[model samples]
Target: MKWPWTLQPFIFYPQGGGQNGDQGWLRAGAEEWTVTGTRLDKASGVVWHAVAGELPPVDTQLSGEVDAHSRLRQMARHTGEHLLAQAFARINPAFEVAAVGMRGPDCTLDLRGSPSEADAQVAEALLREVMVAGPLTLETQLVPHTELGRYPLRRATPLTGDVQLVIFRDTAGELFDVSACAGTHLPLGNLAAPVTVLGLEHIRAGLTRVTFRAGPEAAEYLGEVYRSARALAQGFNTGVAELPERVEALRSERDRLAAEQSRLRAALAAALVTAAPVEAYGPVQLRVLSLPDAGLLPAALSEVPAGEVRAAVAGERCSVGSGVPELDAGALLRAALTVSGGKGGGRAELAQGQTQQPEQFLAEVRRAVAEKASWSYVCHSRR
Candidate 1:
């Protein structure tokens, strides 16, 4: 569960205001416990450190060490969100900061009103300009609740007692932002290098969520993207800048080849149908044929005269069509597949299916047609 640290002089920051808590270790003598997360009990005003392993004695004088890397990452993301929110506000007055999320690797800023692609681009440009303007000065101040109106706040403060305001100013003492916040932020300097927006999506009807990354995290992402692009370009034997053009060219060639292939298949189907010989079985005239491509089955069957029954096989695929009402093509094909070990079905006039045993499938169709059409036994035996 959690260990309460309410004694005095706390070093760990608890999870609050949408930012994650400090993660580290607490040790007293040789006994140590790992703190996975920290949270505040708002009702009791107690900060609880969630830990693993055994808990130390209540009075043990344990010292804690916060994980510096994680803290810095959290700080960078939180600061970047603040600056980006202000940038959006400057772009349009309607784009108010509705909410902020800093729990995960990527932070999100939710704006009150939806913004177009152009508006988002302008906001990102403004943020880039602020990031390169040298180290900014951050000032945290405690002011009476009623005196909050003195400073220009980006939003109304929720705190009822003394309000904590984080103020940002450029080198020339020009104020950039003043907002009431409880989250941990970078004490000073740039809001990490290479802060950029990832993308945007509509969270609701009027709200838009902007995903972004900053500092070391952003650098790592950009590095991976560059490596992936280089690998793809090398596979295509082209430079990274020319990869898109090469891909478009390949797609065009594929379409042209597909159209030519369709034309060739139609010609082959017509030739196969014309070459097959028809055999007379009592009142039924039957024609059997084999095709090279399964896709040509429909075209071949369509060429058969209305006076004849046709059965054709292409690889594992087979089709049977009955022109005479005495033979049911659907029932005939179903019986054949039962012995051939594959599956398909169609109407009585036309039926198509796949079977592993092509010879056995065709023989089954021939035998069934002979029996259903009342062909002379001597004639069936001769065929």
Candidate 2:
């Protein structure tokens, strides 16, 4: 259920404008409610809180707490994104910030103008230079909407009410960037170092999306990569730089072993055909076999004796065929499949199908065969 903000100063920012809503606990003396989610109403500019347990009475003096760790991490990454955007614009005058996202540990930027890998590397290098170059100063100002044109704004202002402008300035008071935003951020964008461009992916017609990480998350990511590289080098008894050749060799060896295993499986299936017992069923010689691979049926049947009737069940798949042209093996297969909830069709001498239950397939085949044998006996007695 939703709790309206009219009764209290629910100053907690609701999830909107690319920032996630705050999550924490709201306490009133001895009772506390866990706030799991929060949302904002665009039409009414109202904030709503989604909480667990019964909310305290209206107008109850509740103490609210926000998860500062999560908030600060997101704030730091957002500031780093602003720095990256500013650097890109300085390097390429035509660069435009199309869309940006910095939530949790994910930081992504999409640009209408395509940026090559080299261009991204250069932008990253420029960001690193400023990272070491003293912390930047930030100032916020509130001014009338008509006076927004006096500064070099990133984009035109859409809101006419008192707008908040966040300005990043170097130590010398020169402006790094002037953009209108309302999210919490660090005083210096460079404080969220060392920001790096992960990679670039071509989204569509001239648009490229760049993924990046900043602050502690970036350090953790690079540490994981280095640890994995060291582990691989130790496992292969080679240096990290020679890992590519060793990995390719291992892949080649794996493929060769897989091929060898397949050849052995096929040979084993064919051998089973020769080992099956020959049984008499009225005028026909029959050999029923169960195997693991249904695809091996054709190869196994190639070794069957002439004039022998065959039925093979492998897992949930089964097939039947006869060397004797007079015997309608296809009919027998269909009759068996019916009992097993399966489907099959072929010439009167051969048929194939799959069964719903592999364990019941053999029993169904035996019943169909016994019924056919009984009918044969009745027809011969009438003759």
Candidate 3:
């Protein structure tokens, strides 16, 4: 589109898919108009904007205004994509740009190749050079299809008639890429600010999707991430740089405590076996051990002899651990289940169960263990 002032021409084809539409005002002398949307009119071979409010009369000196923030971000993402594409080209000459679209605060360039870390690094370096140089120049030209073969054009389909191309050049007049493009672009290297690569992904076997934010969007995204990390550090009373170490320390502490609890349970299991009273269904081991903070039943079970000891522990709730094989422990656990109605299962050699009635589970365990000795019996009360 033509601008009244000495401004570079803009092709309204947007850049990225994830980025949003551009919004800005249009000014013609005293009257100011708002441009709500922009689209390519294929029939007319021109970009048309959906203008709001009254527009200036035809041939009036009018200037198209773009959202500075949005434009800056678009440039950053677009340039970043160029850098990434250039890097991929260096790695594999066969790799080429499939398509490009700029949206919102980001831009996406679909590339055809499996990019490597070296390629990414090269792209980053190229992007850094653009940012350092600044103020890009974009020139558009129409060349005949016959002339396309002379330039290093990356296109799958053959061109017919005349084709529109965008040429990106830096302050030193170094050419970046010359391709048929419809998106708006920054002058040469003048991107308002540098672009940063946020992330990259392999979208398909042969295609790569690079996600990047530029200018204010990049600053904003990074700022939020920093704030979260700082808050986490503050919560742990540590420096921001030390947050990772602090988290690792907390994890290590938890693991150590778990190991200690396991050891204590094993010792308690041995003690419960030695202090049981003998009864009819083998040694009726009834030991009301004060439950530790963890794994009370397994600890108690480990102490008792196999098939001879049936133990129960009372804590925040009640739990049963037995050493008897082929016994329907569920049947024995029914009384505990009736009071609290919790369920659990394990191998025949050792079964465990939980119930909310911590006080009543001890009496229930004693009764359930005494009644059954075979595998087929179901715990009628449990159901």
Candidate 4:
């Protein structure tokens, strides 16, 4: 069910103006209705207020009020749009207002042309000039389309009947910008406070969108930027300008420490090669050593004499090398535990690969030694 209530002396600005509707409360003595939004019908010239809860008595004297803070921000943005359009033209005389919108605290204007960085800066400078200028008074009134030719209109309007012409005039009544518009604006329909040109983005072919913030929104954005910069500078013990240099220095120091730590770890792990348990089989000494560093495995095998062989392991990685000319430690290691999706490859005397079972790899090394020595392998099982 919808109740179309007629409000008198309405403070709510209906949703148009390239911005959202005003939100607030409609009161009837003790009972209150929350106005969540307002919608205006351009065709019927009727305004609807979307509210929560049941409707109040008809013909009941009710009061309405808008969210004052939000209303001010939106008014400032609407005012900023006219200034931006004129500023954009100052940079490129041929530019046209392809689209414009005011959402919350942000305002955007899309022009139908490419705008370079320098062009944006020049426009932004002009935009700020109007934003910071002395109190602006908008001399606007309704005028027929036929009389548009008398003034220096900013753009042509398609409206056939009476059009609302926003006149930029001086105290002496000299004209400046004259454009037809229907959106809500400041009393003077100009920036109430300074504005910030957030940035410009090339959306696509020949369309450049300029985003900006005005009044309280602009001041808040600048405040947040300064606060963040100060926090970063304080944390790094440097000025904002030197922040990049300080960060680079810290990164270099971290890399140097990591490299030094790796060298020390590899040196300490080399001791594991000599610590491995050895099995003597006539002429060959078979050593099995498992360490945490794979790079140190090659150095460990070098510790073995000319007639010895070593199988060094680090995590899932394995390395086998033999000083003996006849034994292929590479083939022997792969054959020991070729189970469970494991694979290996190397020269006849050395091989390095992954193994699921380290103990199985060691067993194969021992078997190769026993077979070479022609010794019968015996399994001792406890009964």
Order the candidate numbers by TM-score, best to worst: 1, 2, 4, 3
Candidate 4 regions with alpha-carbon error over 4 angstroms:
1-3, 8-10, 131-133, 170-176, 188-191, 241-383
Query: Which regions of candidate 1 deviate over 4 angstroms?
Result: 1-9, 236-238, 254-383
Candidate 2 worst ten-residue window by lDDT:
1-10
Q: What TM-score fits each model?
A: 0.72, 0.64, 0.61, 0.62
Q: Rate the local accuracy (lDDT) of all candidates.
A: 0.82, 0.77, 0.60, 0.74
Best of the two (1, 2) by TM-score: 1
The lDDT ranking, best first, is 1, 2, 4, 3
lDDT of 1 at 363: 80
lDDT, candidate 2, 1-383, per-residue tens: 55643324665667765667777778878888877767777798777888876667777887888767776777778787777888888888556778888766768888767888888899999878776676678889997888999988865568788899988887667888888877767877776887878999998887788888888788888888889998989998998888899999999999999898778877887688778887676666778888877767776655445567788888877888777655677887777777778888787667888887755766666666666666776787899
Runs off by more than 4 Å, candidate 2: 5-11, 239-383
Per-model clash counts, in order, read 0, 0, 21, 0
Write model 4 residue lDDT over 1-383, tens digit each, in one string: 35376464466888885888888888978889888778777787678888877887778787888888778887788777777677788778777888888976778988877877777778878756654554467867888888877877777778878889876653345564677887666776345456678888888888989888877788888899888988999998889888888889989999999898767766676666557677887667788887876766766665445878787778778878888766677777677657423678888778888877776777776777778744422321221
Q: Candidate 3: how many backbone clashes?
A: 21
TM-score of predicted structure 1: 0.72
**Against the correct fold, how does model 4 do in TM-score?**
0.62
> Could you say which candidate leads in TM-score?
1
After superposition, candidate 3 runs with Cα above 4 Å error? 1-19, 25-66, 91-122, 129-136, 154-161, 170-172, 190-193, 200-209, 223-280, 283-305, 308-323, 328-339, 342-367, 374-383
- How well is each residue in 1-383 modelled by candidate 1, as lDDT tens digits? 66755534568889988899899989888888888888888897778888877777788888899999999999888888777778888888799988888888788988887987788889888877876776677889988889998998888876778888988887678777788987777877375656778889998999999988878898899899889999999999999999889989999999999888878887888777778887776667887888888898987776456667888899999998887665778888899999887898998788999988888988888777777666544556689
